[model samples]
Target: MATKTDDPKVLAQNRKANHDYFIEDTVEAGIVLTGTEIKSIRQGKANLRDSFVRIQSGEAWLINCHISHFEHGNRFNVDPTRTRKLLLHRTQIDKLFGQMKEKSYALVPLKIYLKNGFAKVLLGLAKGKKNYDKRQDVAKKDAQRDIDRALRDRQKY
Candidate 1:
């Protein structure tokens, strides 16, 4: 049995985003998709890597996110890398625009998933991490993994 905290069905995730930036906040926004595009997404053929969100003209847009063309789409398929608009409230757009003005801050797409039969994107308010920060994170993870291994060994004794 899956817990309520578990996600419904994640289509694609930008795992590198967590390592590259400090996510200050997350917002759920709807994505405007064409008919064939949604079909491809439903089949889990989507990629969030290299994708970023931009707030412009009181709206949010998703760039570089790829939803693969449906196998049967034929001539109906659109460009995989086409920019798509993100549906967000005016206030939310305003907030994102404000945060984006700060140095090194960015709007990034963390994950894409289906919710209540609609496609949603998890948008993050992120600040890029320095090279040293990434190295430190790796070292911290390695240390934590070692500690977990030690605990498991002790428990098995």
Candidate 2:
């Protein structure tokens, strides 16, 4: 149950983004949504998995994001997977475009949240991670967990 509070309420997040890519930078941008779309999102029926951001002709668009149909919205319901516009400044879009042209950079949607009664997306400028990198990360995490568990047991004894 989400209540209206000053803090932003996260509606959806891409958990695999951190595992598949190395996020270099993040930018927050407003997302355009229809009546039903907003309602669906407020109910936490949005999915950021496998969704991405694209800058084309100086405009940013969110592609492949899914927002389930609102239960009460009949005729107003639209395509759940429709492309949506992302509002960003021209300078920011140009910066991302230039960086993308230079390397294997990608724009991944990291999170979708509601702030100040508007929908916002946190876009991550990321580079793809190799399989070896993922393995190393997992190994490090396992080691850290083992060490913490050992210390906790020692304190109990």
lDDT of each: 0.91, 0.95
Against the hidden reference, what TM-scores do the models get? 0.94, 0.95
Q: Which candidate is the best by lDDT?
A: 2
Per-residue accuracy of model 2 over 24-126 as CA lDDT, tens digit each: 9999999999999999999999999989988888999999999999999999999999999999999999999999989869999999998888899999999
> TM-score of predicted model 2?
0.95
Clashes of each: 0, 0
Off by over 4 Å in 1: 1-7
Candidate 1 per-residue lDDT, tens place, 33-72, comes to: 9999999999999999899987767778899998899999
- Candidate 1, poorest ten consecutive residues by summed lDDT: 1-10
